[model samples]
Target: MENIFNFNDESSINNVEIHGEYSLIIVILSIIIAVVASYTALSLNKRASENSFFHKNFWLFLASLCLGFGIWSMHFVGMSAFSLPVSMSYNNIMTVLSIIPAMLASFIAFYLANLPRRNLWTYFFAGIAMGTGISSMHYLGMYGMEMDVVYTYNPILFLASICIAIVVSVIAVYIFSTVQKYETNYKVQLIISLIIGLAISSMHYTGMAAMNFYIPKGYEMNLSHFHSTEMYGLAIIVTLGMTILLGILLLSSFIDRFIEYRANYYDPFTQLPNRRLFEKKLHSPKVLAVWHIHDLEHINREFNYAFGDEVIRRLVYIFKTLTPSKVEIYRIEGHRIALIARDGDSAKQLKGSLKEIATVLRKPIIVKGHEVYLYGVCAVSDANQYENTPNIYTNVLAVLNYPSITYNHDIVYYDSSIHTYTFEREIADDVNRAMNDDELFLVYQPKVCLNPNETVGLEALLRWNHPKYGFLSPAVFVPILEEYDRMVKVTDWIIGRVCQQIADWKLENISFKQVAINIPGEYVTSPLLLKLLTQKLNEYGLESSQIELEITENSFVKNMEEAMRAVGEFRKEGFSVALDDFGTGVSSLSYLKQMPISTLKIDKSFIDDVPISPKDSAIVQAIVTLGESLNLNVVIEGVETKEQVNFLKGASRKPIFQGYYFAKPMQPHELIQWYRETRVED
Candidate 1:
């Protein structure tokens, strides 16, 4: 009571010493705030890369607020530790005003650190500015003290404290900036935060250590304005508020990351697992299968792609209803979806599920108020046998490449025996080479008039002679050409060559009525075919009637409108158009009347068993009658025996015949020689 608290008291104090009491709660809270703020700033800065200006600035603003609030709280809490012999209070105005520089300085610091590209110069300037702001906030808070006392500082310690703040702030900023790129783990971040907190604490204490308090005379008061309870409450409230805010920020950041990951790994349209996630699950043992929509391309070509999309969406919905919840479905790409069964399910069970789905899919769906049916093949691969993702996908895709394995069935398991993919790849290469190297040629099979027993016209056929395989049959290479999309080129070449042959024959005075060329379904709708045909006819100075465009019944069935237009154009230009392989396609009678067909060739299946099988004879007789009524010249195909020719000749109006009974398909020179020989015999 007798002034023993004074530092100058000789009996009570051995040396001139000042005492400070810090609230352990406040110190711990400040450290926690520092760590949380550092984490928030790091998270924000990491996301700032390649972000838009507004996006980067938004995160930078939040980071600044976080760190700024931490700095302000730490400084104020540490200030509450300073103890004196007299009652003291703070100026409420200056106490609130001190937060401005703290936040502004923090904003500058974080902005520079988060710069898309930062140099040493920006870092240095940011550090200095932040340090100045921190120092300003500290001094301003100190000025808030309303006690009747005078304070002075040691210049050296003051300067040292400022330098410590500047140097340490620069180091902290640099660490936060580079930690993300270097993949410095969270432990490193925690350690860096602690070091930063210590630096900040050191600067505050050092500044405090530099100060000396002198009580002014005649400044005594009966009741002091400051209360420890209010200060403690303020510290608690500030710490709790900041802790809650930081917790929310961290939680939101984690949630955003999770959402981003989901977006990357799942398909946007179907909300199913995407190719990225599917590839990741390849190592896990599960039955895998791929559903390929084989007719999606045709559907899209015939109708708009939106109809195709509707089909895919409906199929996915159907598959979802059929599959169990545990099964994983993925849309790998357009018209392809991959299904993976759980470990408990077997490959056989998976195939059954696919079959069920296919059954449901084959049913007609009402799209845009029109009924549309989807056709596809389900190819299953055993994941137990294939461990790698690419191998599994490739093996499954290989089965779909076989021309023999069509989409007519519900499902087809992976058949390793059909080495068609590799074989077809080789054939594709040869066909390309054949086109350029002129390794392919044409042969003409004579079509004879059955009643007169005289040859009328010849049907042109394509033949490929591979250097390795040697004289590959059309049955072998033609399908390969169609598979590889090389048929168009071959068709173009055949048209030009046949037209030239016709011209040459005319020059040789060898008269032939017509040379027929077969066109594939894919090229039936192509404008290029019509253009090429017109160009060849004009180039060769040949009449359109001399060369006939023969398309299969299947082409007309698949695309009736386009095929009709093509045929109409041919007929309009005085060219003859015929529908070949008549009985084999769907609804032969339905299409016969719709097409502009000048000639109808009876399919060989009916002609092969003619005069023996009653059904064959009846079918052929009906087709000939239908052709006659429609004014279409009927040509019977595959007349291999004189019995078949006699059967056709026995009809009231004999149909023309083409097959081995007349003559096998002959080369150009042989055809001319045979023509001369038969003329001489006549």
Candidate 2:
């Protein structure tokens, strides 16, 4: 019985050695092919994960071919190492046919490994397919052998070889799945490749060892005698072809990865390197300038996104045309173009370049037959500003809200003394935490009514005793909050706190004629602030007349009409509005008339020099007389010295004052106690 399964007598099989007679170079070459192909496949794996559906499929298919060819190459090379005693030839058709199963098995294994999502069942099925396919390929190649003998096999040993293949397949798939795309552990991969090579080799030789070949005495061969020369030529041709295929795949993967790298770090619309690449190269001695498009949002809102995109593209051209070769331009964020000088230069040169950029941007561009005018602010890096920061983009963005930059629309260089990026972030974080954690509280500075010799009112001031940075002044933290646009939120919190305190004082039988809270200039006209104020007053069951909103002079100076309207709204709603920092701002008399102000608080600068500088005395008298003529109560703040107080009294018929001279700002309880103690004297 030829091709029979001989279960009973194992002695019927020919003695087969696992190694047989093999060329060391051929065996080593096959292992090398496996290692190289496997490594290339791993390289493509990460890209396959990140790519689009179509591109991912393309890479995955190539990976399958890459790994499959290596497996096919290893099998062929290992087969060539097997030396038979009798003259042997292979059926040409079957020898070629064996590669089909080998490649199919490889594809199944790779497809399972590269599946976007995977689990236990997919792995199990993939292992079964790969193991069965490898076993079938080995036997198919064996079946191609033409010799004057009948072949038989030990079923148990043959089954064991298949089992070994299946187990190895599962292990290989597990390793592939566990490996990360971006990170390649070369040592682990090398070890894995070696292990897989040995496992596949073991299965091939084990199956071979289980097979038996016998002459059967009557068997006759009609085929041509096998030649060593043709076998060598066949081996060389197959090895060369597989080698070339793997090489091409490896080269293609390298190029694809390079292109992917470039795409990730660049803005596709502008074809400019993005913020990520800029930050990677951020360092001292390199000048950076950020240009912000002032009206991009308006353009986007008026026109379509496509029109906005076109506008940005045109702006990119201007940047490219005007920028020198030495300076690298990057489209960092939305409507923001950043310039970095590759050649180390002073901030002065960058500042000039930024000014030129701003001037060029002032011109108009035609987009789709509609002339579009551009306006923007350019902020330049300072030469002497030395602060190590992770995100230079954010550091530059900090300039966007600077008073210097906000008003002038010119290049505001980074000032290390005034602009501290890290400190700002720390303070913001602490403030937010304090807001949430009830760590913030308030203190009050008493306002004296001179004629009555009593504390008439108290200005509610925000206070924070930070665990790390103790007793932070409003001057230090408030400006930073405003720059970050968090002042509105802080103000809302402050309003609630102040209203609750006022309610608490009522319960304690402590009273004041009025209480004032300083409001940011930006919030003077805010509807939200008005709504919040109305709600808080109602919540505390207090009248609006009891609380005053103190606004800075700059608010009225910047937007007179809006400021006046806001002041009128406050007064109409039964709340008093006062103009703070009176003498320091431009057009002092203009603010008094333009604003519907009930009180004018003379700023400390003019009051500080009173009685000492004669010029300061004239300025104080003028402000006092102006307030009296307008029928507005005048408050002189920061009145520290007895001499300044004397001068203020002589200059004005009556004076209401606030500052350290009368009493420093105190906690709510301390204010109540001081009032109780001072009421007796009045």
Candidate 3:
């Protein structure tokens, strides 16, 4: 039944192939069709989301179909040639050439049609229109070809063609899904998908055509065929057509993504839900949900953004699995937890117990192969109250900051009457004060050597004493600075003051090893980092080696390239760089080699329960081994108990320690007095 248009003839003819005026028209028209189809396919793929039925990559296969048909046109026109008689059946022969690519287009459109979608029937009818148009046009066109050819095994050509089609369609589907995976406007994905579509299509069409080309029983190598310029030209033309068209499609796809990416709302980092995505979920009061992270700064600091991102990812997955199938999520600026919960009568009990529901929603996040215990505070509000539409975010934030949540770190219910604008007002006022006030000062947390109990160094921590609002920890104000880009200024002040303190200690003959300054992760990546530190240290007449910089793993892990560069700049200038909060985050061995590190400071979490906690002992042992292997110093912080010190005294061979056991962090005047007393008393 399939062999009606089949011919297995390999009879050689002493006639030229494709040397007629009509053949030229077929090739040209075919090329135009191929061009149109390829571009259309790419356009379809780019707008995959806007259309329901077409799998994201359906357009990719469409491109392949166009290119394949174009090649078929070019190939057959080249095939049906003669030294004498003109091809009266050129249209009929062309029909055979165009069928496969059309079939492929049909197959792809059908796949998309079957997928779960709203307007699938529209695509189904369009698929009918295009598929019918292509096939009918080809069948009517092939009537002029006196010779009929069918796919067969002896030639090994037709099998390759069918295989190629199957592969192209499958690959187009795969590429479409993979490219759309991140849902971004990045150039690489589009380029790769287009290339894949072309490659798969080329292989399919060429394989199908290759089946008709039979080796005359034993002349398989066809050295003659290789020598023939016509055959070579045909292949070259075919390859060029597919390549050029596909290449253009690929480029256009990339350009489209770039444009859409710029036009649409997005967050480049974390790739989670963004503010725009959140807005998309604002339609139905019963169809929306929002979750605001309570301690983003702590997450950013404790493990750095790398782990912080992991926490966000886990939280997303948790809520995603927990929510109803139709729910949507958005992450707003990576701070202040906010989630819009769907208030549906469908789930009556679930809607009423909002607080209980929120607690279940807020759970621990796993990062770096270890579970990080955290509690979430969220702002879930009723979207039904369409009060002031323009200022929904303000209300959302207010709902998130409901006064009840000020004390409760866990999730809180949404209340319309209670506005949580008081703290934000205070913070704004404090920020205004910080711009002019030189009152941000330092407190020295004493660091001591374990065996001798001798004071080694002091970690400089920032303390803000606002005239209006008592004393403030770095925890509160640091976030404000980070949010407002004032962190750099604050960091500069800490560095300068710490350097000045080190110089004063030197003048008093304290020989107080090093003063460590806390560095914010976001600010550490500046190219002028070294210049800033050099200027500060030189201004104080302090040696570079006298100052140490401490970066919590959270900061260190977040911006690896910048972090390493900053560390290298410091170490190159003879300053020491230490990894603060060791054992609290994912410590890649590669970083140990890349970073300009002098020390690893054990975090307080590990130290607070050391000697008693076996886990701490194991972590300390591992860190010490790592330090020894890398030839860097290891210092344990927060060593208050003698048992902890005694444990460190034996286990750490050349170890340095810092903790409350030596002395508490003091003021600059107190540091000077402590330095003088140590010298005079000794």
Best by lDDT: 1
lDDT tens per residue, model 3, 573-596: 788888888878885767777778
- lDDT digits (tens) for residues 91-209 of candidate 1: 89998898788779878987777565678888888888777777778788888878655567889999998888889888877776665444334577776677666656667777888
By how many angstroms RMSD does model 2 differ from the true structure?
Answer: 25.2
Each prediction's number of clashing residue pairs: 0, 0, 32
Candidate 2 per-residue C-alpha lDDT over 1-682 given as tens digits, one digit per residue, 9 for 90 to 100? 2322233354335432221245666667666666676666555544464332236667666766666666666666766655544466779999888877866776677677766567887877877777777788888888887865656788998999999988887776677666543223456666666656655666777887787665443334322332132367547856675666667566775676456546657887888998656654565436678887775878888898999999988888878877777777888777778887644553445556676777766677888998888777776664344464333444565565454455233677666565566568777877788888777787899988556456768888887777654445565577768888888788888888888988888887777868898898888887888899999999999889889999988888788888888889999999988788887778656546667888889988787678889998998999899898888888999876556766786676667889876777899778777777555322
Q: Which stretches of candidate 3 lie over 4 Å from their true place?
A: 1-425, 435-438, 451-453, 506-511, 676-682
Q: For residue 228, give model 3's deviation from the true position in Å.
A: 99
C-alpha RMSD of candidate 3: 24.4
- What TM-score would you give candidate 2 relative to the actual structure? 0.48
Which prediction has the highest TM-score against the true structure? 1
Please report, in order, the local distance difference test score of every candidate based on alpha carbons. Answer: 0.72, 0.71, 0.55
Candidate 3's displacement at residue 551, Å, is 1.9
In candidate 1, stretches whose alpha carbon ends up further than 4 angstroms from where it belongs are 1-21, 28-32, 39-62, 79-100, 111-120, 136-163, 171-191, 206-249, 252-256, 295-312, 344-349, 366-371, 383-390, 419-682
